[model samples]
Target: ANRLLKALFLVKYVDTFKATPRNLTVLVYDRFGLDLTGLGKQVQEALNLLEAQSYVQRNGNVYEYLTNEEQEIEKEIKAVDVDSAEVSSKLFRYLSSDILKTNKLKYAKNGQDFSFGYKLDDVPQGNQRELTIHFITPETSYSDSEIAAQSMGRDELRVFLGRDKRLLADLRLLLKTERYTKQRTNSGATPSMQAILQSKQVLNADREKELIERLRQAVGKAQLIINAAEIPSSSQDAVTRVSDGFQELVSRTHTNLGLLGGKVYPEQQVAGAVQSETGLFDAATLSALNSPGTEMESWIITQTGLGEKVTIKKIVDRFETKPYGWDLGSIEVVLGWLVGNGKVALSVDSNPVVRTEVTDLIRNTGKHPHVVVAPQKAYDHAKVAAFKKFCTDFFDEGAVPSDPTELARFGKDKLAARRDELNALVSSSRYPFVSQLAGVVALLDEVVGKQVDWYLTDFNKADELLEAKEDLIDPIKSFLNGQQAKIFDETQALLNTNAGNLGYLPTGSADTVKALLADANAFRGNKMNQLKTAADTLRGQIDDIVTDKRAEVTAAIDDRRAEILGSTYYANATPAAQESAIRRIDSILARLGGETQAALILQTGATFEQDDYPELLSRLVEAQQGGDDDAPPPKPMVSVKSISVPDASGVLESQADVDTYLAKYRAALVATLNDGKRITL
Candidate 1:
């Protein structure tokens, strides 16, 4: 529209694009060959009005056409905006990619060496070494000045996780399972697919979920190796151990995927490999792809919910004659069209069957237990909500067929079959309330599409006759239940009046009141509670069964739930997944109290299973020794992490903390090739 308008406006002067540059202004009268002199202020007034609208803007002596970005916001609000229901629904389906999550990494980033910050008693046995704790700091480049230990100048001013802590984490490691969700783009599937692929491209390989998961697993078993080292021979050794910790982690990670002959077989390759949460969460936050589930469901779930399996028919005949209400013919036509499109499926069975026969299913670890794919990340909250609303309101369920031949055929073929019974019911005083049902439908149409301008501007008899089938059916169900309740009450009253009905017992005895035949089977003393307890116990056994069977449960559980959990897949299962989760729990618990580790854990819940407890000694560590207690410790370690980018496909230590990573990455990428170094990019 903008392009067409611009082209039409340009044709007024009949000049070349080169002559009429974008910023140049042209008088409307000269281009259209219309005179403004006779019109006086009227012509100029209208042009000025157009200028205020921002479709065109005024320059020194001319009008400049505005780009789309420069256009003024639309002032006219439509009645039925539906506020993004269509887009939001899509986001919910693919929530994992769009959803954001944060996880804690263990241990604070302490540098290679530092002055002992506190008394000898302050050091915990966790990272052991008694300290003389003299601090030496670099006051200037090339000068390692021995100042008073714990000097408070330039070096001391820095604080690792202050308010300005870096949020630039490796996204792949940050959000696994979590996805950035956005509404489906209005442009259709091609662009959407392209965007998804682009997202995949942008994801850094090292930060993938599978890689991080492997590191987490390896770290779980490998950290115990560090426990074996009795002392740090040098400060650098401590740093080296932390760096090596990452590799030790990678080498040792155990996966739910089976290892054949102590190695992963090609067939055992899994899509379930643990990736880095650090990278993923950050990326998810930035991109707003967190709502993977919503995106998938808006388009896909409709097939299941509105398919041929669901059949709609009027229960009563009288309702058909009501103005604009659905008749038996209308229902048949809608159902037939739906079936033709494969939108509905007919099934005698209550549940649908799934087919899942395959090999090489994805499972680097067993089904990740913690999270679902995000529907939409919080980043695009407003947009996703708006799109979802649009889908619900604007999507036409295809146009209704109105040919005379088809209508007559539907009346004969479908309605005639049920005519006798429907007629009899209609004649009866208790004919079902279909008119009441139709009104509810109209209300819902307005509600779901309140923002849609068409709904507000128009009204029709068909709208009044539409029915919210689910809502109408609910009251019918409730009324039937009420009748059933009355039947029970009447039976009870009759039982209470007769002694012979009470098994020939004494009239006043409690036993006489307990009618064996009339009472509900569940009324036995304490049996309700006893049965509930049994049900709970059975449920627990099911959970336990899953835990126990995790070992041979090497196959990934990526299949739809209805397909798995059958007799076949669990033919010989073991506790492999449960054990893995338990091991992770233990590993996380072990790293408790380390500042950096705690920070990561607090955000992520627990990356690894931890098992340590706090002691009273922890209280003593923070105790002040003198007055004006702002005094600093003799020496303290500052946690550090590093990543060095080289010209070649360089290596990175996965375990390095932010500082070390920043230091190395900056040094490698700081200068340009023109400055004597090849650019890291």
Candidate 2:
């Protein structure tokens, strides 16, 4: 199970979206092509095991691989130590340099190998595992410092990559090329577009036969190369940008070819027009008929005069603009107006009642069936100009709507209304500028969405600060401690004074006894009242301190944030640089959280040790306290003789053999763990 799970771990590294369970299943099938007779069930079981072991998190169908955290925890849990107490302490000190979480420390022991492990998690992944220090004892006859140096040297490669610029550059270039090749292969870019189309073309019988044949030959000979551009995965935004560019190209090509093919081929000029015969029209009475092109006159003659019987489709094709036709519904309204105005007579004998104009309508076509009929109707290019202006104005104002959802809703509504207009404009080969409009609108939507998200995040942070509840632990602790000390002293003095007075008083005198009791009662009552008043004042002061500290922390966070935001470098950064800046800001926020948590701990009178910060501890001890930067590095405290994994293969042939081997392994592990000694100052 572990082996299979390890094999499946590659899914985590793939450049796929989300790595959901369904996608994971698909990936396994595609890559391995294993007989999936019942593999889905096996996959589910595997996922269940991983989740149970806390190696991954499955939220709904989405799976987030948690290999890093899992390995880190595993190292911490399995850390074992053996040998003398003095040696163990030195080993722990060595391990402490590696691990961050001091509280994750554990003690264990095993035979021969006296080792201590610590989980290091400075990087994103748990690339750095346990840093173990093996002790050399008299029994083992090994050297201590040698093992320690060996352990540290094991991570030399990683350290070198981080420090050596030239080496890292070479490594990065190699990785980039390898990733590009992998992505190119995975995307199936070679001949993929051609395969996707599968020889499908929009050219029909209406197209020019010779031109269509030529286009077919051209497309067949065309060698398409959909290159998967090399981009660094380290820069996810750049990768996404390249991916989006390819996607946009695919979408634009689809739109152009699918809807505007006929328009592109002039021989099939009316090919883009929809053949709808349902619309009813009367051409005689509408005001549009008188506007231009003898549009109404052409329609009236076609339906009822010397023209042959015509369908709505034919009438629209003849009278309306060519190539891309106008809306059929709008044309119907004009025809209805003509009939109502009694400028044409309707003949009811036809399925579409034929209309005859009051005066005979004639078109001067001369001898040619294909003559220049009417000058192409001029469009208000000014509307396009106005649209551009509107876009510029809208962005320039930069005034956000009160409700975040409102802007989204408005954009959605407007896009829906304009969808037909957009599709029609694009379908007309003449209106190539529509692509620019589409690009602008898409960009606007994306920017607005990002802005909204940013605003909401800011508001949420402010709300959290306002509503947070924190303890005034320092003030309260101080108050209680001071009062307890004072009360103890006063009680001692009262007891002493009473004892002395009692000795001097006459036991037989009733008046004297009564006076003494009254004095004692007065003293007790006065002290109790004073204590109550002091307690109340101290409580109020604690509350005030809590409020003030909250204000102070809030102000500090805000000021630091403002400084970062106001930096000239930040202001001038490109989009990618801005993203990198945001990541740095996230690091700052993490530091702030840690600082606030430490402050709260100190306030509660809990010990907040400087040793908790390994980096800071190094600065304090090694750099500042140790005198100079050029000072010699610290020598290893322990050394390793050999590191080995026990072989169980020969003993695993029989159950008896397995049990015996396990028993010995368990005994060694238990001893190592239990015999671990804590480091003391």
Candidate 3:
């Protein structure tokens, strides 16, 4: 009895292996035999046994196969009784009793017997399954029973079974007999029933063709609904709109059908058909439409060469009028594509548009952005290299950069650095050249320091601007190169010329000139002309100082000569003494005319007031009267001998007594010598 129940459960399990819900009536009649009325109790017992084993679930007369491991069930069902009417009757009674318990139960015609019907408790809910059934006969509508079954909320169809009952019964018997023979031959091991019952439903060529035709009709209906929406019906513009609408519909349909776990139908066939009718979906057409972007780039490059500005309005007008008469919208689209792909550049008011700004510029139409050929990768690389080289050659050597952005950054940094350098030079007091570099610094501020946006956006004109900048800066750089040395040389030369003219006045006479030279040597500016002017002014000052010093020295010498000649000592001196004094003064005057006379006179004048002119006069008079040592003394005219006068007491009592005695003696002597006698004391 256990073996018989197991075999019945195995047959039911195989029939519903696909998870298709089925009731006990169909499960048993379809696989086993409908003539087993007497075995209804046995079938009921077998079902109860299978349910106890957890292999299937019974909801009224409906059964759902639950076990996934069919091998375990095969192992359990070792053998079965081929002629067990008692077991079959038990199963039949169990199914019939459950069906009779349901309140809304009904019956269906099955040849001469009635098939029990019941609701499938385990049927899926929510989304319903869609099925397309093909009938062999040309029936236009469903029968009453079919409609009634469908109304019960089950996707059920009624069909006639054409095979004879005997053949069905024999087929069941043959399966059972085969199972029994396999169990016996293999030592009571049942063969796998799934291998015999599991069959695949394959659609033959005719059915496949019919399914394709049905899909075509459905897609046609979708396209018809899209067409009826009043969209344009000709031209590429119309085709583009239709294609967009078709794609949207296809996407929505796929999403809706995908909810039921249905495979998405490929819509490419219908889409391709629509595209083919208008010749808009081919590769050639897409290439042709995009081809203008390349041409536009070429045109921009050509226009740039001709020094003509290429604006969006100009581009549109050119294409709209030529053999390629594209509309404004189409031209805008192509231009946008060109800019987006980096094939060309767009700018408004001399400023390039960023990626996020491109759309607004293209759509606004009134913006009239200028277009230029986008810098190629190779060209950009070369530009960066050239910019770096220029910076190294003319500015700083460490200013190499790798890309356009870095190139711009490095350029600005270098320019700023140079500006700062020049500013420092201009602000420094040590350098005398500050005032001469005003124009150069102003130029740098205008072209580089203040125009930051130019460096950031004007990549196409980088080389040109750099060249212009170089030209403007060349003179400043040249002037600054050896400027300090030049100023120092000029200052030194001025000092030397003035110092030579001063004629050795004093140790510190050239101090001011030395200071000016020091300033020139230490100068760090680019104002060449200002420094030169300062040098000239210093030279003139030195000339004035030297002239004053020379005149002062000469006047002091002349005053000293005048003082010597007007002195009473010189006046009372003998002729020879006076003559000698005159000669000595003349010699001093002659020495004053010497190259170092100013310094010598300064030294001489310091002792000029302390000169012993009276002593000098005495020596000059003695030498003049003494004559030569070998010469004889001149004879006196009177030839008088020595005469002496004494005081009254033969001693000098008082000056008055001495004077009286000398007078008496002098009178006596005079009287005595009245005949021309000469007196000597």
Candidate 2 TM-score, C-alpha based:
0.13
What's the candidate order when arranged by decreasing TM-score? Answer: 3, 2, 1
Off by over 4 Å in 1: 1-380, 383-431, 441-473, 481-681
Best by TM-score: 3
State the displacement of the C-alpha of residue 427, model 3, in Å, after optimal TM-score superposition.
0.7
- lDDT by candidate, in order shown: 0.28, 0.34, 0.45
Residues 1-681, candidate 2: write the lDDT tens digits. Answer: 353465457665665566655556665675565767577777778887876675764433455565664444323322322223433333234323322223222211101111123222112222232222121222222233332343332311111001222222222222333333344446655474323222112111112233223323322222111221211222123223222332322332223222221211111211111111122322332233333223453555655555455433444454333222222333333333333333332231321122222111211112123211121122244433333333234323343222222233343334344444434544552312233334433433433433322322321222221121112212222323565335434533443434423332245322332333233222222444454444344334444444454455545545544654575434554555555555654554455444423246233221112122122222222222323577665321111111122564454788888788877666655444354411111
Better of 1 and 2 by lDDT: 2
Encode model 1's per-residue lDDT on 100-196: one tens digit a residue.
Answer: 1111112122111112111111122122211121111111122212122222221111111111111112222123212321222333537645454
* Candidate order by decreasing lDDT: 3, 2, 1
Q: Report the C-alpha lDDT of model 3 over 365-398, residue by residue, as the tens digit.
A: 6775554334322344455566667666656467
Q: Give the better candidate number (1 or 3) by TM-score.
A: 3
Better of 2 and 3 by TM-score: 3
Off by over 4 Å in 2: 1-289, 299-307, 317-324, 341-343, 350-681
